[model samples]
Target: MQKVCWPYFDPDFENLRERIYGPTCRVSIDNESMEDCTVIKVDSVNKQGLLLEMVQVLTDMNLSISKSYISSDGGWNMDVFHVKDEHGNKIRDQRVIDYIQQAIDTTRETLSSSSLSSPKAKAKVYTNSTLLSSDHYNEHTAIEMTGTDRPGLFSEISAALADLHCNIIKVHAWSHNTRLACVAYVSDQRTDTPIEDRSRLATIEDHLTMVLRAQPTTGSQRATPPNQQEVKASDLQGGEGTMTNVERRLHQLMLSVRDFDEPASESSSSPMMPMGLGPDRNGQNPRISIEEWNEKGYSAVNIKCKDRRRLMFDTVCTLTDMQYVIFHASACARAGYAYQEYFIRHIDGSALSTEGEKERVMKCLEAAIERRVCEGFRLELCANNRIGLLSDITRVLRENGLAVVRADVETQGEKAVNAFYLKDISGNEVDMEFVERIKREMGPIMLAVKDETRRQSSSEKPTMPFPSLGGFLKSRIERLSHNFVTIK
Candidate 1:
């Protein structure tokens, strides 16, 4: 092979002039060097999180960031880190250069798909365009989209920005084969455009949906494989949970955030896990994300419960005509912890901002779970590692006339997880201070929520369809129309 010089990433970039092509390429690396140390300045708006991922890349390249001040607004993000190699060699090596080049190349290819061949002044200037607002710019506002992942998903979105005279400062895209998930950082339109270009946005979304639908593997490309309990294809064909061809044909889709007027506590009204507390008042009103669901996309107001409640299904998915598939999903629940985590995705950005309605909506989910499982209770106490609090806990419950039925305890990740099934004399399970009592006695809790046992009555296959796909999709679209840009 002919002699070639690689890109440089070290403290001695200036001295590289003596190296082969260095005479003309005179590149000054953004590194602030110190004795036995160096700083590499990486300036890029990471929408696909190239810079963010670069932190890991640097680790793989045997580099370290001593300090970093990163900021991500809209889809564009930036991370300027001070890095150094362990050997204090100034990190001017081939592997470091290669890794940086590879990362940038991958980002370029991803951005090119959206007609963003040149990252120049596109995302930034476009965000300030006139199409979004006639009054003032909403700096904190962000754009989230989910449709059939496509090559021009970025191009079309950026084109929409261009049409609206918006500037795209930064963006992030992650694609696996045929489709992708990307976020673009944009501002108000730079040109004189109306704030009502929503029809245009809808048009772009629809077009991409059709393009994705036309692909042969669109349906199969993004499917979550059935669980161990799921029935076979033959069983699904005639089964109520199975989907018909027509029902599966959803093109590119869009679900905008609809802010609710009430507080979230009141809105999130549904039967959920007694223990799994969804986002409450303190946390940001998270966008709704339905996960591992089968043909059961939920509405915005009802979506939060899916996580905390873990409405595990034996049927289809929440979204339709998707190219991505999930194989196995297991709820990660830990007993006796402060909170249980529910991993999900609001693919369409259907339930956008949490605003004032977050707390109430979450409580609704808790109430639902409590209603279904708390009817008859059991308060069984187990041997806790923190023996001191055990007495206080039991004393509080017993003094208050709470009964203990069955209980077991085990350690999980340095904390104890206890399962208690108890009941009162009247056979009625009712205790408001149940959570408070647990905290008071065995505090520093991680998931002090409820996991009231659920009993599905009846033995016969209750419904025609194993899972209701239509019901899921119906809920997704309706909630998206409710608008609330108001943030606390």
Candidate 2:
């Protein structure tokens, strides 16, 4: 059995966290029955604080952390725990270790599942700045704003920033309605905006607030955003509870990933250009920026594709040319190219005057993404605010043996972007041709033909975790590791 450790063992914690209640910090978990509890071990550096956080994960997984061991080593700290619940099927089961592993993997993956992103996991995760490996970039504060979802939402914000001359650096946008208002985050490169320019920022926020509050949001989001604190600092602490043999292995893998500041540097191979991936005008700067121009529906028209130079200013120029306002931007890239996607608020509304025009715009946008966007080896297709059979898509993909590794679901109004990060069950590269094949197959499924509609109805049973993906993807990984699995 591998040893499990902790991350919440901060250096200054010991002198701060209280242990009057018997230094209860470490978390122990039983996989087979989630309720099977045991003791835990922790470190002296805020042992209680670490354990307190561990309990959250345990609770989420339906387990419990009773007692723990807390201490510190050199500069690093560690926590171990022994927990107990009424459930004891784990120790009796032969596959308990497998169950534990599944739990750990699920918990680990849960934090990053695209379906459940905090502001940072947005569809557009970049600003107009350059992508660099500098420390200053990571230290910047990140914020996200969400309200009602609708159209012209992005443009309204862009307009507000235009008034402030605050360039729209980057935008990761999501909406839940054809009429759904939207939520977007803009990062400004005005790094020198005096550390005390509190008023300036507030004025901008006020502008955005007014813009959003004035928009319409219907269906579910009409209610206030859930008050249950969708985010918590403890969630960021990672899990600190005790592990079954399986969880220990999963935990080790996760530890290795986080042990470093960045995952293995992204391979420097040519970027797989599905969207706008090509040389720009300067040939030395691939920092092309796409602006939202479709009046009724947002649009990203290809601006430039060139070389590897600082195209921050030029990127800004493209946004200005579109008569869009920049809210914020960041420095980002792919394959050493000076690449970044900007989110500007356009001045005009949807260029469409009728339903047919809007439909045409959406169809064209979908086609562009399908033919152009490829991440790693997987092609991504996003559909938002449309009601169509999603289950049939999952089944056909399963038949094709493509397992989804991650899924993120977000709703703005009637539209929800269900983003799936998938891969071939057999860990090999999935080529463009294969993606096309799936698309061709899905084309029929997307259409509600009589037979297809019947099939969609049968497959549309309320989805399981991921409807059809969770099982194949999870089990495939377990097999690749040749580990046994037990469902808890």
Candidate 3:
């Protein structure tokens, strides 16, 4: 069987470099008709992960999204959201909107500037005027890529585009015949406009071609027969996890920051008992043990498990997300075993001295490791953009007791494409019954959104596109008050 590769996750710094910045962005918040809710409207150049980032910012600000609509036509993106602060009040502050606009604008500026300084600029370029004809320059720059499918391929392509200062407007990807094919519509990041510079366009194309052609040293590549597979140079160490060749090199480079003068003694080594966690599921047990060094004022964390592609990313991302700071770390993989150790402190510069905190950290790490090892069922859907579409889909999943492990949603033209990786709330495979129930609930909601959109456009007198599903749900909920008088 072909080995499936996990998705690639770049360090936080790399995420900034990969961010797509729109040339023009406008944000406005108003509260006229909605009660205790603010309506936010945004128009900008569409890019990958843009919506999610916006959502994150709002979430961080303690705002709840009551309803939302997102649409992208070619390069332009439009989004409307109804939100309320934690206190259940509309945000009437102009300064808040200004802050959001400024944040997005700064991101765009950074993306544009970073692309102009890509390392690929130093590489040899072949002139291809035909690819940049006037007609092509006026239209969206179309990028078509084909290569052996592997985990993290999408991330690589996205990184290349970001480096080249290309703003992806639309994307369609599929895997077939053990190969991947992807086509994207992109625009010039600096102008939020079409590609007019033939030389620049040619350079972008060349850079992407090179990226696609380059073989990834990650184990995500189709696994060869045991006898035919050649041992990689970095995997010579008998360590527990699978590290890509690039990751291996990067890991070594990062380890240079560790203080080598620290007292090195075998006495501190942990002797953890075997923990049977997901052994039958993924053929590996994720074990994490924490040891505190009172003299050093830091905690030592040791992790051992079967190495898989992007294992390092999964571990690091979990640690960072949990607000842990790694003062020092080492990782190695050999003979299908991966081992990782970290000297860490909390974000507040405290060690994990509490048993509760240590247990929480271990549990989170185990969950992250399991996710990387065994993925959930992924379903992709594309439909016309509609208000409250996301909310409706999520509600259906909730009602069906389905847990969404991961989701990515983007819009192109008038259609919205969404991919969801699903698991049962009980942490089991989603059976056919659950899948059918979701479909049954989703079918009407989708049709209602589409119907509402059509009606609003055709009617001269503008009407509300669709009633908020939240409202209906609220009405269905019964209220019992102690002061209420019973009437016969």
Q: Best by TM-score, which number?
A: 3
Q: Per-residue lDDT tens digits of candidate 3, residues 357-389? A: 898788667655653332345655555644334
Q: What is the lDDT of residue 359 in candidate 1?
A: 52
> What overall lDDT goes with each candidate model?
0.32, 0.32, 0.49
- Residues 176-205 of candidate 2 have per-residue lDDT tens digits of 111111222233435522212445555555
CA error at residue 473 for candidate 3, angstroms? 24
Off by over 4 Å in 1: 1-28, 74-76, 86-89, 111-488
Name the lDDT of candidate 2. 0.32
Question: Which 10-residue window in model 3 sums to the lowest lDDT?
Answer: 268-277
Give the CA lDDT, 0 to 100, for residue 17 in model 3. 32
- Tell me the tens digit of each residue's lDDT in model 1 across 166-227: 44432333222122333433434444232335565444334433333333232322322122
* Per-residue lDDT of 230 in model 1: 27
